[model samples]
Target: MIHIYLCEDNNRQLTRWKSVVEKYLLMNSTESQLYCTANSPDELLEIRKKSTVTGLYFLDIDLQSEKNGIELAQEIRKYDPRGYIVFVTTHSEMAVLTFQYKVEAMDFIVKDEIETLPDRICACIKNAEVKYKTQLDSSSRLLSVKVDKTSLILDQDDIVAITTCEDYHKIMIHTKHGVRQMSGSLKELIAVLNPAFCQCSRSAIVNMKHVVKYSREEALLTMDNKETYSVSIRMLGKIQRALKQL
Candidate 1:
């Protein structure tokens, strides 16, 4: 389901835009389930921190607060890098400012051209949905591990186990060539992967797809590679539940 967030401060404008968006969605039979409205950057940040959003944002470039919509978009990118951002503004010149945020904004709808705004927004939403789906299909979760000065993309399925060595976490991948060493933090790596990957222990996050069998009593995970890894007692139930879903 798509989760749309509208951050417009003007009550009348907000109502008009909301109606436009809702009408477009209904006409197209869009599968948007959650719609959040915020008047300020602070409110947007709060909603972003608490919610798992997966759709377009119709943000006002000029807000009534200290921080503007561009600043809020930068903050949103930190957590949700894939969300579609669009600027709704009175000043068309502000379009260049989007490059500073490094956000691939779908479009900038000029408030003066409010008559055409609904059609423009509808097109952007459809485009964003297509791009989002394509990304999900083409990309598997990659754990980037820095080996010396170079970084490599380690597929989650290729990982056998993780072990920490001093400050860095060593990732062991069962490649067609052999096992290889790549460095990263287990905590940071987990954030990029799907939540379905459960931590067997402090050092290892066994991919749910690779787990062939799990022992709750011993807190152990046996992968499809026939290698066994120990899970901490605290994570036993999580591992068991993840394995069951397979």
Candidate 2:
């Protein structure tokens, strides 16, 4: 389920947006729920920590506090990297700041267009719900690996590749965020992973979902993130078949 959050400072605007969101929720039967509403970034962040699932956030750019919407979004990303963030603010000029902040806001909604505010908000919710459902469905399977003292539970879809490290006893997990070194064997890890993972070589197992292009001549597989991995000649046929299934 996609939890929804709203953060607006002004009482009137807050009430208006809350009303619109509540009405939309009542009228439509979706997996999205109006989770929380806050008058301050602190309040929102406080509650955001409790959410274990992805969220859809509608934030006012100027929150009249030290942490504005963009900054709050940066903080939110640390916890919910795959969540949707939509900025609803009167200051349309602040839209450019989202790019500088690297928040990847789904949309910048201007409150000046009062007539369209409700529609835009609902639209963002609708679009986010569709995307959230897709991710939730694909993420039913999880991979748990120990990174140092911490155990990280990851969505199988997020893993780009897993390769044996130089130490042989340790493996390197290549994800979109970064690489993580963990103690494990490729054969052992493959036993726990889904069918989407294919061992391209003795040292590396690549997620078929992340395989962008494969060159049989070069015996290389290019990932969606542009990282390349070599495939053993014996595994070329298996890799080709797996990619075709994707």
Candidate 3:
């Protein structure tokens, strides 16, 4: 299920957005639900921590927090890079920083324009519903990996992990298809990988989608196929943050 998250500190503005979003979802018959309306970034993050699902975020720029909406989007990306993020702000001057953040923001709406605010918000949600549907229909994304000697193409979604083999100056690409030793480094391999692939260590990178179990006791990550990888204690923090929560 798709969830909508709204974070606005102002109670009156929050109520207005909530009403519009509720109406939009009902009118379009979108199964998506407005999960929570938050007055702070922490509140929204807490709600997401409890549920693992596709999400659309509409955040106000100035939350009066040290970390603003842009930073909130960055934090959300740690767990869900594919989640749609739209910034809602009263100040238009802050709009220029959206591109600088590289959060793949869908749209920026200025709240001062009360007349057009609902229309803009409705449009972004409608477009997001279409985009999320297309992603669901495809299920998996594909990528081509090129090496000096051979070219290999595979489903990026099937990848379990990519690790550096220092001996051969190559990368051991592990996928559901099986392991393939390709001439590449984690640095080079990561450049082509999708956001689902996260660097757990200087040597290892794992596809968060394939991590079925993570053991803090053993500092190990168990894959869907039951293959286990020892996660470095230092990188464990980042690995946990990037991994999808149940």
Candidate 4:
């Protein structure tokens, strides 16, 4: 689901942009939940505070409020760093201010050339999805695992490798002092992780961040600790692509 926010002061332009965005979403077979705010930066900020946005934003520079769209964008970034922001304005000169908010702003669009605006917004949303997934995976949550009747809350990031054993899997995690082992099945353990941690073999689903080297010919993954695990030939390409993104 994509949540889009539009901040435009002009009634005519706001309606037109909303129509264009709706058409684009319909054509792409995607559902968009849109929040429209006209000329009010305070209302826009309030909407953001109440919503969990996952998509792009179309903001107008010449807002009716004292704070322009650029200033509101900086404020938005404080809470939602992953949302895509596109500034829309009649004044092309305001494009220079993009440098100040480039970290949050994905692109700037001229109001007259609104024909090309939908494509840019769609592209930015796609890019944001990829980045959002990466960020979510990098910040894996802690989980408690029971091994031989002993329960432990393991830091997911400390996990170096995981391998299946009969009906269970052995998880090798690196602590500040040394490595420790926990028991669980690949399927059971994998459900707790994001897509970034992919299965490289029938017996193993390794953390992409822990992978330091890989050999397609040898069908193996070498972790930062110098331990090598066998990678199935069929899953090698998938593992390689995932690692390359890192």
Residue pairs whose backbone atoms clash in candidate 4 = 169-184
| Best-fitting candidate, scored by TM-score | 1
Q: Note each model's CA RMSD in angstroms.
A: 14.4, 13.5, 13.9, 14.8
Give Cα-based local distance difference scores for all models. Answer: 0.72, 0.87, 0.82, 0.70
Candidate 3 structure quality by residue, lDDT tens digits, 11-47: 9999999999999876664446799899999999989
Tens-digit per-residue lDDT, 1-246, candidate 1: 356788989988888778877887766543453367888888877878875546578999999889888888888888678888999999789889899768778788998886788888778777876665556547664445566666444445445555555545465545322465566667776777766577778777766776777776776778777878898878877876777677
Off by over 4 Å in 2: 140-246
TM-score of 4: 0.52
Clashing pairs counted in every model: 0, 0, 0, 1
TM-score of each: 0.58, 0.57, 0.57, 0.52
For residue 45, what is the lDDT in candidate 3?
Answer: 92
Question: Considering every candidate listed, which one attains the maximal lDDT?
Answer: 2
- Model 1 misplaced stretches (Cα beyond 4 Å): 140-246
